[model samples]
Target chain A: MLELIVISTLNGVLFGMLLFLLSSGLTVIFSMMGVLNFAHASFYMLGAFFGFQLTKWIGFWPALVLAPLLVGAIGMAVERYGLRNTHKHGHVAELLLTFGLAFAIEEIVSMIWGKSPLDYRVPALLDFPAFTIFSTNYPAYKIFMLAISVVIFVALLLVLKRTRVGLIVQAALTHPHMVGHLGHNVGRVFMVVFGVGSALAGLAGVIAGPALVTQSDMAASLGPILFVVIVFGGLGSLPGAFIASLVIGLVQTFAVALDGSLASAFGPLDPSTGPSVLTDIWNVTIAQVAPIVPYMLLVLILIVRPMGLMGTRES
Target chain B: MRKLTLAIAVIAPMLGHAASAEDTIKIGYIDPLSGGGASVGEGGLKTFQYLADELNAKGGILGHKIEIVPLDNKTNPQESLVQAQKAIDAGVHYITQGNGSSVGAALSDFVTKNNTRNPGKEVLYFNYAAVDPSLTNEKCSYWHFRWDASSDIKMEALTNYMKDTASIKKVYLINQDYSFGQSVRTDARKMLGAKRPDIQIVGDELHPLLKVTDFSPYIAKIKASGADSVVTGNWGQDFALLLKAAADAGLKVNWYTYYAGGAGGPTAIKQTGLDQQVFQITEGFANSGNKAAMDYEKAFRAKVNLSLWYPRAVNEMRMFKAAAEKANSIDPVKVAAALEDLKFEVLDGGTGIMRKDDHQFLQPIYISSFGKLTESEPFDEESTGWGWHLVSRIDTPQAMVSTTCKMTRP
Candidate 1:
C-alpha cells in the first residue's frame, strides 16, 4: 500500500511538472495579451517535430535547444504579423485567429510528418532506470524531465522577479499605456513575452516528444488539459496555473492508481438483476473515470467559483 | 459539424460521374485523409490505387477501367456517412472504407439504408481493416462485405496460441474504451477462460479511446500487477504511447495486439527494443515468403514511399475483381452476390474465403513478432531495421469462428 502511494505520488509529480511546462506559457500569454492563444499547444507540437527532425541530424542535446528557438521565432512572427493585425478587431477576433492558426498548423504538421507518431527515442544516456522501488524501475528519462522542468520553472521565476526585462514585462502587463508614456517599446515587450511563452511551450514539447507519443494530434490531445489547468488554477495567474497543473496531474494520476471501485464502496450489487444507470456506475472502477475528473472539475469550478481558485478576473 | 461540411465539400468534385465512350468502374475510397488517422488512410489509399493499376494492367475488369475515387472522411463517422452519400450520388457502384470501426459501422448502416431506399442505386461496401466483430455479426448488412478478419476470430487465434505457449501465465488486458475495445476485452476473457483455465488475468484497464497522451500511470499499474503478457486492441497513438511507456519503464512483457502492425506501430516496437517480445495477429506481414507479393510490395513501396501495411487491401481488390468477373457485370447487386462465399488466393501466399452468412473474410491469420531482419525476411515497416517474423500461422479452418449474422437479402 505504501509503495503504491509512493510510486503514484512520484508519477503524479512528474506528470504535474509536464502540465506546468505546457500551461505556464498559456497562462502568461493570456495574462499579458488578454487573449487566449489557442495555438499555444500547436507551438509545442512544432517544437516536438522540429526536435525529432533535428535530433536525426544533430543529436538530442542540440535539438533540445534549437527546436524551441525555431518554434519561438515562429510564435513571434505569428504574434507580430498575425495577432497584431487582428488586434484592432478586438479580443474575439484575436481568439478566432489563433484558433484558426491552430488548425492550420496541425494540417501543415500532418502534411510534413504524415500524421503518425514519430520515432523520438530517449537518448541512450538517459534510457536506464533512475531508481528501483518495490521491483519497479523508475526511468531516468522521467527524472531528467522532472529536473529540466524544475530548472525552467526556477529560471522563469528568477527572470521575472529579479531582472530588468522581467520588470519591463511586468509593467507592460498591467500598464501598457503608462509604460509607453515612459518611452518604452511596449509593443516590443508584448512580442518578446509572446515569444518567450511560445519558447517555453516549445521546450516542453521538445522534452515531451520522447516522453509521450509525438504525433500530429499531440497538440490537440494536450491543449484542452492545459486550458483546464489555467482555468482551474485561475486564468492569468502564473502561480495559480502552476498549482492547478500539479493538482490536476496528481488528481488524474492518483485516480488511475487507486483501485477503488464503486462496488467496493457500495457493496453487493448484482448487475444481472436488470439494466440501470446505478448498475452501470457500480461496475465502473475509479480508474475508468479518471480522465473525466478534469472536465468535471472544470464544470464545477465554472458553477461554484467562476474566477477559479487564484484568479483575479471574473472570467 | 464543420468537419462534416468540409468532407462533403471535398467529396463534391468526385460526385460528378460523366459517362464516356470507355466505361470506367468507380470505387470511392473513404477514410481519414487529414487527421490523426491520415497515415493509415494514406497507406490504404495508395494500396487501393496500386491495386487498381495492377488490375488495369491485366486488362480492366469486364473491359471497364477501374478508377478509385479518393475521398477524405477525417476519421469521423458523420463525415464518413456524408462521404458515402456523395460517393453514391456520384454513381460509384463500389465504395471501400477501413480505419475506424465507428466509421465502418456508420457506413455499413448508411449503405444498407441507401440500398433499401433505392435498390437500383445500390453500392457495395468493402471493409478492408475495421475488425469490430459486430460489423460482421449483430450489425452485419448485405450491402457491406468485410475483407478483413473480425476481432473475435483474431482473438480466438491469439488465445489458442496462448493456451499452447507454456511461457504465458499471468495476463493483463488493456484497451481503448469503445465498442471495438469492449468487444476485444470480452472476447479475450471468454476465449482465454475456455482455452487456458490455468492462465490468470491479472489486470484489465481501459482508457478513453484516442485520448490518452501519457500512459505512464497505466504502465505503472501493469507493472504492479506483475503480468507476464498483455492483450490489447489499441491502435494509433494509444498503441504507440502504451508501448512507449512500457519501454521507458523497462517493463518486459509480451504484447499481443490486433493493430500493432498499424501506422506508428513499427516505430514504437523499435523504440521499445523489444526485439521479438511484441506480438501481432494479422492476415499477413510484409516479410512472409511470397515472391509475387514481395515484388508487388517493392514496386508499390518504391512508388508511394510507404510500407505495405495492409495486405488485406490487396486481397479486397483481387476478390472484388474476381467477383466482378464472376458476375460478368458492373452492377453492385451482382458483384455482392458473387462476393458471397468467394474464395481467392491472398497476396502473401494464403487462401481466403468470404463467409456467405456474415460477408466476413476468413483468412489465414498469422501471429508474428518484431525482430531483426533475417535472410528470409526482405521488408520492414517505416524502414525500421526490425521486421515481423512469423511466429505461428493459424490456417483458415482453425482461425474461422462461427458468426451470428442474419443477413437480409436485397
Candidate 2:
C-alpha cells in the first residue's frame, strides 16, 4: 500500500507536469490574446515532426533547439498573415480559422511523414534509469522532462510577470491603442506573444514526442483533455493551469491505483441482473473510470463555479 | 430509417445495374482512412489493394477485374453507415472493413438491412480483423463473414498455452474500454480460471480507448500488484504507448497481447530491450519458416513500405476468389452460399475452413515473441533488427471453438 501511494504520486506528478508542458503555450496565447489558438497542439505536432527530421539531419540536441524556433517562426507568420486579419471578425472567426488550420496541418503532416509513429528515441545520454522507486526504475529521460517542465513554467512566469516586455505585452492586450500611443509596437507585441506561445508548444512536442508516441493523431487525442485542464484551471491563469494539470493528473493516477467499486463499497449484488447502465456502474472499478474523472470534474466545476478554481473573471 | 432504406432500395439498384455492366467486381473498403486509427486502416487498405492487384494480374476473378473502392469512416459507426450507403449507390457488391468492432457491428447490421430492403441487390460484408465474439455468435448475420478468429477463440488458444507456463503466477489485465477489449478481459479471466486456477489475477483494468497519452500510472499499478505477466488487447497508439511507458518505468514482465505486431509495436518493444518477453497471439507472423510466405512478405514490404501486418487479409482475398470460382458467379447471394463451409489454403501454409455455422474462419493461430532474430528468422519488423520468433502454434482443432450463431438464409 505504501509503495502504491509513493509510486502513484510520483507517476501522477510526472504525468501532471507533462500535461502542463503540453498546454503552457495554449494558456499563454489565450491569456494574452483572449483568442484560443486551436492549432496550438498542431504546432506542438509540427515541433515533434520537425524535431524528428532535424534530429535525423543534425542530432537530438541541435534539433531540440531548432525545432521550436522553426515552429515559433511559422507561428509568427500565421499570426501576422492569418490570425491578425481574422481578429477583426471576432473570436468565432478566429476559432474557426485556427480549427481549420488544425485539420490542414494534420493532413499536411500525414502527407509528409505518413501515418506511422516516428522511430524517435530518447537520446542515449538520458536513456538510463535516474533512480528507483521501490523496484520501479524511473528513467532519467522522465526526470529531464519534469525538470524542463518546471524550468519552462518558471521561465514563462518570469517572462510574462517580471520582464519589461511582459508588462508591455499585457498592457498591449487590453489597451492596444494606449500602447500604440505610448510608442510601443502593439502589432509586433501581439506577433511575438503568439510566436512565443507556439514556440513553447513546439518545445513541448520536441520533448514529448520522444516520451510518447509521435504520430499525426497525437494532437487530436490530447486536445480535449487540454481544454479540460484549461477550463478547470479557470482560463487565462498560468498558475491555475498548472494547478489544474497536477490535480487532474493526480486524480487520474490515484484513481487507477484504487480498485474500489460500488459492489465493494456496498453489499454484494448481482450486477448481471440489472440494466446495462446500472450493471456497468456497479461493476466498474475506480481504475476503469479514471479517464472519466476529469470530465466529471469539468462538469462539476462548471456547475459549481463557472469562473473555475482560480479564475479572476466570470465567464 | 425504414423509409430511407426503402428510398435507397428503389433508386440504388438502377445505378448499381448501370455500373455492374463495366465487367468489374467492386469491393468497398470501409475503415478509418483518417484519424487515430488511420495507420492500421491505411495498412489494411494497402494490403487489400495489393491483393486486388495480384488477383487482377492472374486474369482476375472470372475475367472481371477486382477493384477496391476506398472509403473513410473516421472510425465512427454512423459515418460507416453513410459510407456503406455511398458504396451501395456506386454499385459495390462486396464491402470489407476491420478496425473497431463497433463499426464492424454497424456495417454488418447495415448490410443485412440493405440486402433485406433491396432483394436483387445484395452486399456481403467481409470482416478481416474485427474479432468481437458476439459478431460471430449472438449478432451473426448470413451476409456477414469473418476472416479473423473471434476474441474468444484467441483467448482459448492463449490460455491453453499459458496453462503450462508455471512462471506466470500473477497476471494483470489492461485493455482499452470497448467491445473487443471487454471480450478479451472477460475471456482471459474465464479461460485462465478454468485452465490454471493457481494463477492469481492481480488486476483487471480498462482505460478509455486511444484517449490515454501516458501509461505510467497503469504501469505503477501493475508493479504494485507484483504481476509476472500482462494480457492486453490494446492496439495502435494504445499498444505502442503502453509498451513505451513500460520500458520507461523499467517494468519487467511478460506481455501477452492481441496486437504487439502493429506498425510501431516492434520499435517500442525493441526500445525496451525486453528480449522475447513480449508475446502476441495472431494468425501468422513473417518469420514462420515458410518459404513462400517469406517471399511474399519480402515482396510486400518492397512494394507497400509496410510489413505484411495482415496475413488474414491475404486469406480473405484468396478465399473470396475461391468462393467466386466455386459458385461460378460474382453474385453476392450465390457467393455467400459458396463461402459457407468452404475450405482453402491460407497464406501461411494451412488449410483453413470457413465454418458454415457462424461464417467464422477456423485456422491455425500462432503465438510468437518479438526479440532477437536468428539466421533462420530472416525477416524483422519495422527495421528493428528483431523479429517474431514462433513460440507455439495452435492448430485448427486447438484454435476452433463452438458458436451459437442462428442465421436466417436469404
Candidate 3:
C-alpha cells in the first residue's frame, strides 16, 4: 500500500510539473491579456514539429532553443496581425478569433506535416531510467521535465518581482488605466508578455513532444485537459494553476494506483441481500475512478472556493 | 513573337495527340486530407499515388493514361458530399474511398445518388479503409465496393481466438464513444456470447472522443473487476495513450485491440517501451511474402520518409487496376462487372477475388504478440536490432455475402 502511494505520488508530481509548464504560460497570458489564446496549444504543437525538424538536422539541444524562438516569433506575428486587430472587438471576440486561429493553425500543420505523428526520438543522453520506486523504473526524461518546470517557475517569479519590464507588465495587468496614464507602452508590454507566455508553451512542447508523441492532432487532444487545469485552478492565478494541475494529476495517478472494489470494501456482501442497482455497481475499480477526479475537483472548488486558492475576485 | 509562335508550334502536336484520345479515364481518390483522420488519409493518398505511378509506368490502364484526381474530405460528412459532387462534376468514373467510416457512409450515399442522377457515367466506389459493418450490411450501396473487413467480421476472428483461451475468463470492454466504437462493442458482445458463453463480462466503459487523456481510471476498473482480458477498438492517439496508461497503472490483464496496427506499430512499441505488453492485428498485407509489397514499402518509405503499417489503400488500388484491365475499358459499370467476376491473387498471397454475393474480397488477418527483440528477421527494417514477431496468422475469409443486399446481382 505504501509503495503504491509513494510511486503514485512521484508519478503524479512528475506529470503535474509537466502540466504546470503548460498551464503557467496560459495563466500568465490570461491574467495580462485577458484573452485566452485558444491557439496556445497549437503553437505548442508547432514547436514540437519544428523541434523534430531541427533535431533531424542539428540535434535535440539546438532544437530546444531554436524551436521556442521560432514559435515565439510566430506568436508575435499572430498577436500583431490576428489578435491585435481582433482585440478592439472585446474579449469574447478575441477569444473567438483565437479559437478560429487554432483551427486554421491545425489545418496548416496538417498541410506542412502531412497529418501524421512525427517519429520524434528522445535525446539519447536522457534515455535512461532516473531511479526505481517499488521496482518500477521511472525514466530520466520525466525528472528532467520536472526540473525544467521548477526552474522556469522560479525564473518567472524572479522576473515578475525584480525586473523593470516585469514591473511595467505587472502594473498593466493590475492597473491598466494607471499604466496607460503614466505614458508607458502598455501595448508593447502586452505583446512581450504574450510572446514570453507563448515561448514558455513552446518550450514545454519541445520538451514534452517525444514523451507525449508528436502528432498533428496532439493540440486537439491536449487542449481541453489544459483548459480544465486552467479553469480548475481559478482562471488567472499561476499558483492556483500550479496547485490545480498537481492536484488533478495526483488524483488521476492515485486513482490508478489504488485497488479495491466497492464489493470488497463491503466485505463481499451477497448480491441477493442488496438492491439490484447497488449490486450492479459493486465491482468498481480505482482506475475507473481516476478520470472523474479532475471534474470532481472542479465542482468542489467552484462550490467552496470560487475565487480559487490564490486568486482575488475581479470586483 | 517568333519565340511565342515557336513554343505554341512545339506544344500543338502533343496537345492534339492527347485530345484525340477516345475518352479520358477519370479516377477519383477521396480521403480525409485534413482534421483528425488526415494521418490515415495522407498514407492512403501516398499508396494510391504509388499505384497510379505504377500503372502509368506500365503504359497506362487499357492503353490510355490514368488521370488521378485526389480530393480532400477534411473528415467532415457534409464536406465529403460536396467533394463527391465536385468529383462527379470533374467526370470521374471510379472513386477510391479513404479512411474513416463516417466519411465512407456519407460518400456511399453520395455515390448512390450520383448513379441515379447520371445513368450513363456510373461512379464505382472502392472503399479502402472505412471498416464499419453498416457500409456492407445495413447501408450497403450498389455502387460501393468495400476492400476492408467490417467490424463484425474482424471482431468475429478476435472473439474466436479469445474464446479458446481459458485464461481469459472475465472480460472488460472499452471503446471510443462513437458509431465505429459502438458497432465494434456490439459485435464483440454478440460474438462473445455466441462463442464463449462461459466468459463473464465484468465492465464496459465508453470514453468521449479525444477526451480520454488519462486512462488510469478505466485501467483500475478493469483490474478491480478481476477481468483476465480487456478488449478495445480504439485507434490512433487514444490507443497509444490507453496502452501506456494501462502499463503505467500496472494493470495485469491481457489487452486485445484491433486498431494497434497504426499507432502501436513496431516503431511505436520501441519508442514507448511497451513493446512487450501490446498485441496487434495487421491486415493480410503484413504477411505477404510477395516481393512487390516489400518493394512498395521500401519505395514508399524512401519517398515519404515515414513508416505506415496499413497498406489497404495500395492493395485496393492494385485491385482497381486489375479490374479495369480485365474489363479493358474505363466504364464504371463494366469495371464493376469485371471486378465482381475477377479472381486474382493480391501481392500479399491472399486471394483478391471479390465474392459475387457481396462484392467483398477474401483477405487474411495477422495476430501478433509484443515481446522482447528477437534476432529473427521478419521483414526488412531501415535499421536492425528491433522489430515485432508474428505470433499467429489467422486466415479468416471475410465473406460479405452474409450482409449483402438482395437487390445487387451476384
Candidate 4:
C-alpha cells in the first residue's frame, strides 16, 4: 500500500508536470492574444519532427535548442501569412484557418516522415536510473524532464510578470489602439507573443518526443487533453493550468491504481449476460476507466466552476 | 432499384464474358487505408499487392490476371460495410481485411447476409490478422475464412510454454479493453489457472484501446503487485508505450505478448534495452531460419520497405490461388468449397490447414524473443539490429482448440 501510494503520487506528479509543459503555450496564446491557436498542437508536432530531424543531423542537446526556434519561426510565419489573412474575417475564420493549417501540417509531415514512428530516443548521457523508490528505478531522463518543466514554468512566470516586453505585450492585448498610438507595433507584439507561445510548445515537443512516440499523428493524440488542461485550469490562467495539470494527472494515475468497482457493492456481473450499459458501468473497475476520469473532471469542473478552477473569464 | 437489378442481371453475363477475356481476379483490400490505423493498413495493402504481382508473374492465378482493389475503410466497421458494398458493386468476388476484429466480424456478417440474399454474387472474407477467438467460435461465418491463429489458441500455447517454465511465479495481465483484448485476458487467466495452478495472478488491467498515451501509472501498479511477468495483447502504440513506461521506471519483467514483433515493436524493445525479455507468440516472423521464408522476407522488404507482418497474408493469398486452381473456377461458391479443409504449405515451410469446421487456419505457432541477433539470425526488424530468436514452436495439434462453429453452407 505504501509503495502504491508513493509510486502513484510520483508518477502522477511527473505526468502532471509533463501535461503543464504541453499546455503552457496553449494557455499563453489563449490568454495573451485572445485567439485560440487551433494549430498550436500542430506546431508541437512540427517541434517533435524538427527535433528528431535536427537530432539526427546535430545532436539531441543541440536539437533541443534549435528545434523550438525552428518551430517558433514556422509559427511566426503562419501567424503572419495564414492567421493574419483570416483575422479580419473574425475570430471564427482565424480559428478555422488554424484548423485547416493543422490538417495541412499533418499531411506535410506525413509526406516527409512517412506514417511510421521515428526512432527518437533519450540521450545516452541521461539514460541511467536516477533513483529507486520501492524497487522502481526512475530514469534520470524523467528527472531531467521534470527539471526542464519547472525551469520553463518559473522562467515564463518571471518574464510575463516582470519584464518590459511582457508589459508591452500585456498592454497590447486589451489596449491595442493605445499601444499602437504609443507606437508599440501591436501587430508585431501579437506576432512575437504568438511565436514565443509556439516556441514553448515546440520545446515541449522536443522533450516529449523522446519520452512519447514521435510520429506524424503525435499532435492528434495529445491535442484534446491539452484543451482539457487549459479549460480546467481556468482557460487563461497559467497557475490554473499548472494546478489543473497536476490534479488531472494525479486523478488519472490514482484512478488506474484503484481496482475497486461497484461489483464489490453490487455482486459480480455475469459475462454470459453479454455487453450492456448497466453491466459495463457496474463491472468496470476504476483502473479500466482511467482515461475517462479526466473528461469526467472536465464536465464536473465546468458545472461547478464554470470559469474554471482558476480563471478571470466565466466562459 | 428492381429495374436496375434486372438490368444488371442482363448485362452481368456480357460483363462476365468480357471480363473472362481480360478481366482481372479482383480481391478488394479493405481496411484502414487512411487515419490512425493507416500505417498498418497501408502495409497490408503492399503485402497483398506484392503477392498478387508474384502470382501474376507466374502465369497468374489460373490464367486470370490478379488485381487488388484498395478500399479505405478508415478502420470503422460501418465504413468497412460501405467499402464492401462498393467492392461488390464493382464486381469484386473476394475481399480481405485484418486490422480490427470488429471490422472483420462486421465484414463476415455482411458477406454472409449478402451471400444469402444475393446468391450469385457471393463475397468471401479472407481474414489475415484479426485474432479474436469469437470470430471462429459462435460468431464464425461460412463466407469468412481466418488465416491467423485465434487469441485463445495463442494463449493456450503461451500458457503451455509457461507451464513448463517455473521462473514465472506471478503474472500480470494488461490488454486493450476490447473484444480482442478481453478474449486474450480471459484465455490467459483460464489457461494459466488450468496449466500452471501454482502461478498467482497479481494484477489484471484493461485500459481503453489506443487511448492511453502514458502508462507510468500502470507500471506503478504492476510494480506494487511484484509481478515477474506480464501477458498482454496490446499492439501498435499501446505495446510501444507500455514498453516505454516500463523502461522509464526500470521495471524488469518478462513481456509475453501477442505482437511484440509488430511495426515499431522491435525498436521499442531494443530502445528499452530489454534484450530477449520480450516474447511474442505468432504464426511466423522474419528470421525463422527457414531459407525460403528468409529469402522471401529479404526480397519483400527490399521491394516494399516493410517487414512481412503477416505470413498469414501470404498463406491467405497463396491458398486463394491454389484453391481457385483446384476448383477450376473463380466463383465464390466453388472457391469457398475448395478452400474448406485445404491444407497448403505455409510461407514459413510448414503445412497450415484451413479447417472446414470454422475456417480457422491451424498452423505451427512460434514463440520468439526480440533481442541481439546471433550469426544465424540474419533478419533484424525495423533496422533495430536485434532480430527475433526462436524460443519454441508449438505444432498445430498442441495449439489447436475446439470450435463451436456450426457453419450454414449454401
Candidate with better lDDT, 1 vs 3 = 1
Candidate 2 chain A weakest ten by summed lDDT: A267-276
Query: Taking the tens digit of each residue's C-alpha lDDT, what string does model 1 give over B163-280?
Result: 9999999999998888889999999999999999899999988888877767878988998898999999998888988898888777889999988888788898888889999999
Candidate 1 per-residue lDDT over residues A215-278, each given as its tens digit: 8988888899889999998988877887887888889988998767878887958757786877
Q: Write the per-residue lDDT of candidate 2 for residues B243-320, one digit (tens) a residue.
A: 988988889899999999997999899988989999999998899878889999999989988899899999999999
Could you list the iRMS of every candidate? Answer: 1.4, 1.0, 4.0, 0.8
- Show the lowest summed lDDT stretch of 10 residues, model 1 chain A: A268-277
Q: RMSDs, each prediction?
A: 6.2, 6.1, 5.7, 5.0
Highest DockQ among the candidates is held by which one? 4
lDDT per model vs. reference? 0.87, 0.92, 0.74, 0.90
Candidate 4 positional error at B305, Å: 2.0
What does candidate 3's lDDT look like per residue over B1-410, in tens digits?
99999999999988987774536566787777766777777776776666677777887777767666879888888887888789888777788775778888888888888788777968888887788877877687778887776777778777767777788789888888778888878888888998899998887776666666655445555665788788888888787667655555555567787776674344455565565455656565332445666666667677766454556666676777788778887778888888884676655556656666566665666666655655443443223235445665566463222665554542
Whole-model alpha-carbon lDDT for candidate 1? 0.87
Candidate 3 stretches with Cα past 4 Å from truth are A1-17, A50-113, A122-167, A174-188, A246-315, B1-22, B160-172, B192-203, B220-230, B246-255, B275-277, B299-311, B325-328, B369-385, B396-401, B408-410
Candidates ranked by lDDT, best first? Answer: 2, 4, 1, 3
Top candidate, metric lDDT: 2
- What value does the lDDT take at residue A182 in candidate 4? 94
Error of 4 at A2 (Å): 1.3
Candidate 3 lDDT at B79 equals 84
CA shift of A26, model 2, Å: 1.4
Q: What tens digits encode model 4's per-residue C-alpha lDDT throughout A154-195?
A: 988888889988799889988989999998888888888889
**Candidate with better lDDT, 2 vs 3:** 2
